[model samples]
Target: MAAGGERAKPAVQSRMENFRKVRTSEEESPLPFSDLPPDVVEMKVKEGSKIRNLMNYAMAQMELKGRRQIVFSGCGRAVTKTITCVEIMKRKLGGLHQVTKVRYKTLLEVWENQDPLPGGPAQNLTVHKNVPSICILLSRDPLDPNETGYQPPEPAAGLQAQPGEAAEDVSGSSSKGLKRPLPPPSEELLTKKLQVQGAGDPRGTGASDHQPDHHQ
Candidate 1:
């Protein structure tokens, strides 16, 4: 009876294994990109385009409206420098207000355009070029020194004047008057003072018996 029961257990185990279920392909998770809606994908691309446009418009507005100093700089290439300037201009405008009505321009397009600030006929107009990085102060004419009214640095005497001549003093007269120079120190006195200080005497007496007898 025991032998027959053991033989029946093996047949039952085999039947259980054969009946076990297997998962189908449909049970796996859906891919991330595949699950996104078609509309969402289209909107993402459009949003990128709008951001670019906003940056460009801000760059132009910064030159036209804000009138801030425009500085362009980048490593490696001129195109990179142009893009950096545009992007910086965008951020600066965005900080002031919401980015709206912005127009975007590519590096190649910006290069083909004239200098943002032109001379002569195109005063107050800017012309961008593929030259090295530079800080452009907006001016009507490149030759006009007073156009931008940029203050020249003052001289060491706290005066601003044309080169070669000293500035005018409080009397409105040119400061050409010769000022008295400082007198030189006597070296003998300076040496004596230094020697006394370096002697390191506690009472500061240089071999003088100025103290009373200690026994008293």
Candidate 2:
């Protein structure tokens, strides 16, 4: 029993050490949190605050799963991966993703019916005992359903460039000629578009004009 206990201590310490490694990188530019523009810094603070709050909820709450609420929860290196992956996913998916911060109690409620128990040492330590340090949610609806959001298809080179500007110097442009492209429409938009189409509204011609592009 003494030898086994001694073995376990090293593993636990190893895990904690791995966790610290995830927080810092040997080669990376330092973020200019202090010198950044106020608005940019404000946004960073907001995102950081959100991540911290979500982590707190996970630590106190128990049991996390994917899909039901798109949770990103784990500790140490796992936690770092969760955060990095979620941010990338959000940017790539654009408005298709939604995020929410939930507590561990909420997790247990869904996966284990409020019972916080396990059949083995690993399960016992991982599920109910070890606190989660992060939680991220991605939903199907990042944008409101009632709003009209249409993103025009990307323009071919030279197709939409200014009269004298070279295509290489051209910036991102959509078919709609708008400065900002709207996110893809939600299910509600399709339904509304169908309704208008049936009613013979001229505006319902194509997916592009079916919904108004309202920036949120």
Candidate 3:
């Protein structure tokens, strides 16, 4: 009886092992490219880019736009840089409204190799990877930031240009004026002048003919 019971236990164990299975489902996340608003100003950030330059550009853009709104976006390793830029801007241009968004992007990889069996077709493998992304929106408008928390920063002059640092002042006057030296007259201008000179004289002796008064 003991031997029979042990054999039956082995059969039950094998059946359980064969029937056991794991089921998993992944949540699909889509990028927010299409959902971005057209009116909002956008700036794309990369990981290896200079933060100081980006901060300057961002500050200038905000000053130029009448809407007083700007957004920064980044993916993968660049996401942290994007946030850092926003923080710098916030501290510099205080009294700004803020909005933030996060999402994941999926990447795919495929590989093909020869099959173990001789003269068989190449086998292919597929893989999927998800990368994170973020977007930060800053504005001075009185409305909500949509899905992102909004905390208005207090007004400050963090980036105010000093006497020697006037280069950062966008709205300030500069010694370098936009007025450039007038270029030499074009051929058309010379032709117009000749025509005027010819028209002014009835004798058809254009301005070039300044007859000399001689004693006859």
Best by lDDT: 3
Report the lDDT tens digits of candidate 3 across residue range 10-128: 87675444432232223345334334456766777877889988887777777765557788888778899999998888777778877677887554555444323367764555566
> What lDDT score goes with residue 89 in model 1?
48
**Per-residue lDDT tens digits of candidate 2, residues 137-185?**
4443333333232222223444446554754345434434563455456
CA displacement after TM-score superposition, residue 83 of candidate 3 (Å): 0.9
The TM-score that candidate 1 achieves is 0.15
Error of 3 at 66 (Å): 3.5
| Candidate 2 TM-score versus the reference | 0.24
| Residues forming the 10-long window of minimal summed lDDT in candidate 2 | 105-114
TM-score ranking from best to worst? 3, 2, 1
lDDT of 1 at 140: 20
Model 2 misplaced regions, further than 4 Å: 1-69, 100-132, 142-216
Q: Which candidate, 1 or 2, would have the higher TM-score against the true structure?
A: 2
Per-prediction TM-score: 0.15, 0.24, 0.45
lDDT of each: 0.35, 0.40, 0.66
Badly placed stretches (over 4 Å) of model 3 are 1-37, 107-127, 145-148, 155-216
For candidate 1, lDDT tens digit of each residue in 11-84? 87764444322211111122222222232211111112444554465456455565333322222233344455
- Lowest summed lDDT across 10 adjacent residues in model 3 is found at 18-27
